[model samples]
Target: MPEKTIAEFSVKYVQVMDEKGIADAKLMPRLSDKQIIEMYRLMVLAKAFDDKALKLQRQGKIGTYASHRGQEACQIGGVYALGKNDWLFPAFRENAAFIALGFPMHLLYAYWGGDERGAKIPKEFNALPTSIPVGTQLLHAVGTAWAMKLKKKKSATIVFFGDGATSEGDFHEAMNFAGVFKTPTVFLCQNNQYAISVPRSQQTAAETIAQKAIAYGFEGIQVDGNDVFSVYRAASEALKKASMGNGPTLIECFTYRLSDHTTADDAKRYRTEKEVLEWKKKDPIERLRKHLEGKKIWSSRKEKELIDWANEKVEKAVKEFEAMPAPVPDDMFQYLFAAMPRRLREQRDYLEKYVNELRREKNG
Candidate 1:
């Protein structure tokens, strides 16, 4: 009888799925048919929300918004790997990730529409409020993981940040602390190749962002960011390790941002149309759709049905967001502190009086 040798090589970064729709049998995640279908549906819903948000921003319904257009697989795949008890600390561009984790679409839209209430996640969910300052949330995630370790909890923490954030001091500090303390955390960096107009080459000189984990004494792996299977497997493995007290793992999902950094920026000024066109060929949804087709489960009819359902859901959310009453000016002051400072209270009172006086004059 032949001795079963333990596999010594690293997992290949999955790219195209075989024509049979099975992940390379040796490198695949053990995903169920129901899970695959759910992943695909979530991806479609995310893309729809992104499109609608962009449209709303253009029409001035929302403030400047970021589109996670081509990076759905990376975001969804990474977040879906976590257990319900695990926590998520996200950067600004992870709309799909939050949505996949049960965040209401209307809350997300409301956040972009400039309502602070949008940042509030339900107590039942372990997601943190979205962090806008780049790289700052990494520290918070590390702290949470550290606390969990001290409390002897079984959960892990996942922090999502962009490649550009890797250059920040907070990123370094978080990694260093997680490594030194052996905290249960996974640092998921979505290296989408650009930070606003700045390309990855300009962001760092390292061969790969994941490789940076070596400096912190942890394992790191780079996976195809556009391949949901690869992203999920990598993240899941890292998360499993973290949950078992193996410390942190850095997983870099190599992907690209196919749209402008945000609605406020003009990507055309820095990137060529040809480059965007080229990346479009690597569309995450198309890869999954092709794989599903190969399995004979995905058809044009099914695709249309799913898309229509997603569109209707998005439209309904939009209506709900729009129907909410206009926010009061005083509402902004309410959350700034546990109790308003005297100066702010004076300003609030003065503004209220001024508005009332103006209304009276107009009525007269």
Candidate 2:
């Protein structure tokens, strides 16, 4: 038999803006000056929310929370590309994504505070509650996309996960199904370089995470996750292709997690300060700020106004979250079923009575 060449593949890496904040004008996405400013504002809000969440966690105001300190551009940029009717299936650590998609800040605050009510998304938005189990939401996203395809809808679905998720069997299966079915879905993997303490080098052997999509018969693109414009352009293009009935696109966002994995995690144990400092030079918010300044669209006064506005919004959300009524002792059993199961009802009633007794004793 004669040797023959089967196929050759290539992956594209996108970067509209460099670390020095200079952008390739021809590669810039079509966005108004106002919209670009809004992107910066949203990134600021994400950082503000993250800072507050960490403080709240330290003070025992909220439970152990995941912080998206450095990944704001990856989250917000991709999410901002979605249409109103598009759906989002997110893994945890996506606070900025939710905010960019117009989710209420107070609700996100409540969720981090361990309140189940916060997961109940408003009817107008098409987003699922946060999935804590790694790589599991891919199935849900695929199913939603299949449904959209069956119904012949123009909307697409985006699923967000981390580098670690790409190693899961569920991720591979989801990709296969998405390819075979030709579903309108976008797989957005935020490769933040670290899956908790494990580094990206330890996650997989593949040269680039984006190449994983080729096995499933789809195109994958790697973008500068720290550059908001690059991430936004990749996501926007993928979404448009999907809406036009194209199959899935896997976007590998090459970024870093600036903070510890979560409140319970101490990244210093595994990584060095020098490494963190190196990544800090590519900080997304600062890069965008620099870009805006070069265009003369941003000034010291505008910076102050932006920070103050973000602070005000965060403060209002915190107050609302704190002022909300406490969950009833039996509230845990209420959300799962329209009518409680018999055995669950008995347990709930017992807890309710016990809580009442405790209240009565306190009153006396």
* Candidate maximizing TM-score: 2
Task: Give the worst 10-residue stretch by lDDT in candidate 2.
Answer: 327-336
lDDT of 1 at 233: 89
lDDT, candidate 2, 135-177, per-residue tens:
9999999989999999999989999999999989999999999
Clashing pairs in 2: none
Local accuracy of candidate 1 as per-residue lDDT tens digits, 21-128:
555667778899789989999999999999999999989999989899889988999888999789999999999998899788998999899987777687887998
Instruction: Identify the leading candidate in terms of lDDT.
Output: 2
Candidate 2 residue-wise lDDT at 68: 93
Task: List the lowest-lDDT window of 10 residues for candidate 1.
Answer: 11-20
How many collisions per candidate? 0, 0
The lDDT per prediction is 0.89, 0.92
Global Cα lDDT for candidate 1: 0.89
